[model samples]
Target: MTITETSDGSITIVALCGTIDSSTAPELHKSPAIADTLRSVVIDLEKVDFLDSSGLGALVGTLRLKQEAKAAVLLSCMNPRVRKVFDITGTVKLFHIFDDTSAAVEYAATHNEG
Candidate 1:
C-alpha cells in the first residue's frame, strides 16, 4: 500500500492506493503525515482497491485521534469496494463522507477551522 499527502491550506488530504488490510494497516498507523495535519484531515480512498476489518479499525482509530485533537477528519470515498468495509462495519455513519476530493476539501475548508 502507498500513502500520499497533499495540502489545501491547513486541510491535509491523505490519498491511499492499493489494499489496506491487516498487513498494511500498521503502516498507515505509523505514518507521520497524519500527525502533521493541523485543523483538518481528509482520507481520500479514490485509488484504494480493498479494505478489511483491520483497515477499518485503522481508519476509526485515526478518526478518533483527529477528533481528540479537535481536528475534523473527512473521507472521500467513491469506491464501492472501500465503502463496503465502512458500511458493513456500521462505521460509515461516523464520518463525513464525500463522493469526490473537491467536495471533501470544500467541507474541510468551510467547516473545519477558522
Candidate 2:
C-alpha cells in the first residue's frame, strides 16, 4: 500500500492507496504520518480497494494509540468494499467516520485539543 500525507494546521490527512492486508498492515501501523499521536489524523481510504482483517486491526490499533494520547484519529472516504468490512465486523461505530476528507479534517482540527 502507498501512504501519503498532507497537513492542515495540526491535523494531518493520510491518503492511502492500493491494498491493505497482512503484507501492508504492519507498515501502515508503523507509518510516520500517523505515528505522531500529538496531532489529530484523518485517514483517507478513498483509494484503498481491498481491506482484510489485518487491515482493520491496524486501523483499530491506530485509533487506540490516538485515544491514549487524547487525540483524534478519524476515517474518511471509505469505499463500499472497505465500508462493508467495517460494517460486517461491527467496527464502524468505533471511529468517527466521514464521507468527505475535508469534513474529517475539520472535525479533527476542532477535536484535537490534546
Candidate 3:
C-alpha cells in the first residue's frame, strides 16, 4: 500500500492507496502522521482498493489513540466497499466521515483541541 501525508494547521491528511489488509495494517500503524496523537488527522481513503478486518482494527486503534490525546481523527473519501465494512461492523458511528478530503481537513482543523 502507498501512504502519502500532508499538513494544514494542526491537521494532518493521510492518503492511502492499495489494499489495507494484515500486511499493510502494520504500516498504517507505524505511519508517523497516524501515530502522532497530538495533531488532528484526516485519513483519505480515496485510492484504497480494499480493506479487511486488520485494516479496520488499525483505524479503530488510531481513533482510540487520538481520543486519549483529545485530538480529532476523521475519515474521508471512503469507497462503497470500505464503507460497507464500517457499516456492517457498526463502526461508522465511531468516526466523522466525509465524502470530500478537503471538507474533512477543514473540519479537523477547526475541531482539533490538542
* Candidate that scores best on lDDT: 3
Candidate 2 lDDT by residue in tens digits, 43-66: 999999999999999999988888
Error of 3 at 79 (Å): 0.8
Candidate 1 residue-wise lDDT, 1-114, digit = tens: 999988887687889899999999999866676764344788899999988889888888888877777788889965987888787888978898999888888888888532
> How high is each candidate's TM-score?
0.90, 0.94, 0.95
Task: For candidate 1, list the clashing residue pairs, or say none.
Answer: none
Candidate 1 structure lDDT: 0.82
Model 2: residue 21 alpha-carbon error in angstroms: 0.4
Q: Per-residue lDDT for 14-102 in model 3, tens only? A: 99999999988999977898888876889999889999999999999999998999998899999998999999999998999999989
RMSD of each: 1.9, 1.3, 1.3
lDDT for 72 in candidate 1 is: 85
Backbone clashes counted, model 3? 0
In candidate 2, what residue range of length 10 has the lowest lDDT sum?
Answer: 105-114
